[model samples]
Target: MNQTAVKRLYLMQVGSMPEYQIPIVCYLVQTDDNRNILIDTGLPEFIPEEASDFVNGQDVVEQLASIGLKPDDIHMVVSTHYDIDHSGRHAAFTKAEYVVQRLHHLDAESNPRFVANRPQWDQPMDRIRLVHGDTELLPGLELIETSGHVPGHQSVLVRLPKTGATLLPIDAVPFGEDFSRNGQDDGKNPDAEAIRASTVKLLELTEREQIGLVIFGHDRAQWEGLKKLPEYFD
Candidate 1:
């Protein structure tokens, strides 16, 4: 039999970052071999109305149900970082092996920014597969180590059979201006140098791989143009 590849990519809008007025996203990848991989669970079960600010969508579990997937159906979970919006629903999945960069996990232990989110992403050590630097987690799926947005932050690249390779530089390059402008400091992350380097790395990869589809982390314009769930990329 031929090697399995990602057969479907689902883009799910889990909530909105009201302060910035952009939709918060998470993704689901269904492989041709009947495996599912989740990329960054959305918000937690509850948040004060004040904290929610304005728009908020369904939780990750609920979103998964729309396409007939439960928590256990997921085989792997990739945590790009521990930011509140990205990792809030992580505790919902107990069966999947969580993947994260070792340094990011270490930094999360003491870094105030990430420490606050320990409860969300600090899964059992037995189930956490901490990798250093970049790695190909699956045949067609590769994790791009792109720190600076936060320490040990990582991005994703999924090469599908029909749709081709897609670059998902989650938070590493959240906005299109980060690309057209050559990755300027967004004032959100102080590690501007790291952010720039990671951006350039992703850009070079995008060029070398000839990747045409790039699903950014929280770009409203980009999200609006995408083929959202119920519609798969492949």
Candidate 2:
């Protein structure tokens, strides 16, 4: 029972791999009351040496400026997971309280799989708000616990005023193809069972809610169809 609705949802394409046809994205959710919640940080100040050619774009900070916002303007940051591309510019947002799932912060802290990405997301821990299971972050914004891509990955469900409800199944369902399928054992992620279960969970939720639109995690094909930055989904 939300009293207010999300004003706008801006998708930012921060990085892309021409070889693999992959595009990295981060989202900004603007509440009716003018609160800003950035979903994931795009990339760091410097791209990795090996991935330099494949991944290239303006970082999250630069992208925010295009929409007349700075890092400090964001009140909250919803970290879906601590993946390399997702949690890069977290420390830049000095004013935001980071939101993350409890298990993700713990497991990633102790037994982190990505050694290179550890330093980027490990900081600003003092301002973290760790929630368990599905949570209504605000009146119109909800956090969907879809942990399949990583230890405790989560997705977002935003209810916009005119557009109705939109689901951003980040990493949990990487491509648009995943939406129609009953299972998600794509072999890309290690946990096949978790992927399948989480996929089904999202499917059920989408059907029950009659979601207005669904945005995949890193689908390059789907990415082209979405409105980005200055143009938003509202």
Candidate 3:
């Protein structure tokens, strides 16, 4: 019997940026077995200028196609939360399975907090798979529940033999520095207590699991310094 080895996972930057701001971060995680798992769908190409100020309106389909894959090729999509900029074009992958926290889906459906951003998330209700707490979606990838940014935010854990371990802690911690400080000092962010707890938990998990890399939701400075896709462990 042939074993399923997780060869590599790639991150495609499908967003734009300005001179000083950080480019939004959305990624496609391609496994060795040809499973295309997309992390987040960036803001749509056509958004209002006021809203676009906070979004990166790039061509996700074209970006994926650049690497020889199509939006339809995506097998799974893991959304950390239903923020406008993060979960905008989820409909692009019409046939892909979705992984999301249970609370996130519920909040996106009927919560007043998401009233302003309902259009971005409310449309993709049909393709979702809701779960509570943590989950291992596949052989080497695990979803860690770290809800702070929103009611049901979560991150992904990718364990590979060569790359060691990687924590894709979506918006829970926008950058590595967020983990270092308690939320009391982090300023206008999520709930302070939740943020602090999530940060500490992620740090503990990384140390316990021997994780070597961390990918944040919107940290361009960090993403720019990492290895790109199509380069996997042999």
Candidate 4:
């Protein structure tokens, strides 16, 4: 794989919402060397019906196959955050090494504000790898530490050889417009300051990195414009 040649990456929105009809996204970052790296598995049906309602319906495994991938085919699983909707049924990627920021995980479980409000993802401790700081998953893909929404929350930064750079902001700012209107304050969570700081960090990153794309956790419009799996980077 030539570093000089542009690499194409893709996003797969597996689950769906009845309200919006938008699929819940699970990313697939293909490197120059043909490595398949998955990010954030979707929710499974095993969870309570009410809890599962926020997620998209299609099985994440089947969704991957629609794009020519099986669960075992994934090399690494990058979790942006531990929200029930985002974490989904991670057990599917039994063979992939899970990656997440250490601080984000600790804060999510320990912080009174988070524990009291969004306590869904506080899973059993044995789930996956608890990473720290920053990690480079592949040649051009790196996990940047941006923890605002939850303690262990992080986002992905992919630098394709040809496309320059793209930042998968995750839930740092729920939507691209969050930063624009100071909507970082959720009114419910007390971590508003932390969330705002994380958003600023992302803004700084994209400006400095010359990022061509910015992906969010639930940005339906953005995902709709992106190339999906199996047909990525054509």
Question: How much does each candidate deviate from the true structure in C-alpha RMSD?
Answer: 1.8, 2.0, 2.5, 3.9
lDDT of 3 by residue, 1-234 (tens): 665556567765656556546666667766767888888787766765546566454467777777798878999888878776677677778879888889778877787665655665555556778889988887788888887778788888887767778788888887766766454355666477787788888989988987778877667777777665544422
- lDDT tens digits, residue span 26-48, model 2: 99999777889999997777777
Better of 1 and 2 by lDDT: 1
User: For candidate 1, lDDT tens digit of each residue in 1-234?
Assistant: 687678888999999977788988899988888999999997777754434663558978998999898998898999999887898889889899999999999988887765555687988899999999999987789999999888999999999888899989998988877774366665766798888889889999998999988888889988999998878898
The sequence of per-residue lDDT tens digits that candidate 4 reaches over residues 164-220 is 787888778657668543667767767777777788888888889877778776777
Candidate 1 residues lying further than 4 Å off, grouped into runs, are: 48-55, 186-188
The number of the candidate with the highest TM-score is: 1
The number of the candidate with the highest lDDT is 1
List residue ranges in candidate 3 displaced over 4 A: 1-5, 16-20, 55-57, 112-120, 123-126, 181-184, 229-234
- How close to the true structure is residue 137 of candidate 2, measured as C-alpha lDDT? 89
Which residue segments of model 2 deviate by more than 4 Å?
1-4, 50-54
Ranking by lDDT, best first? 1, 2, 3, 4
lDDT of each: 0.86, 0.85, 0.74, 0.70
Query: In candidate 3, how many Å is residue 185 off?
Result: 2.5
Clashing pairs in 2: none
Total clashing pairs in model 2: 0
Compare candidates 1 and 4 on lDDT and give the better one: 1
Question: Where is model 4 more than 4 Å wrong at Cα?
Answer: 1-6, 19-23, 50-52, 107-127, 181-183
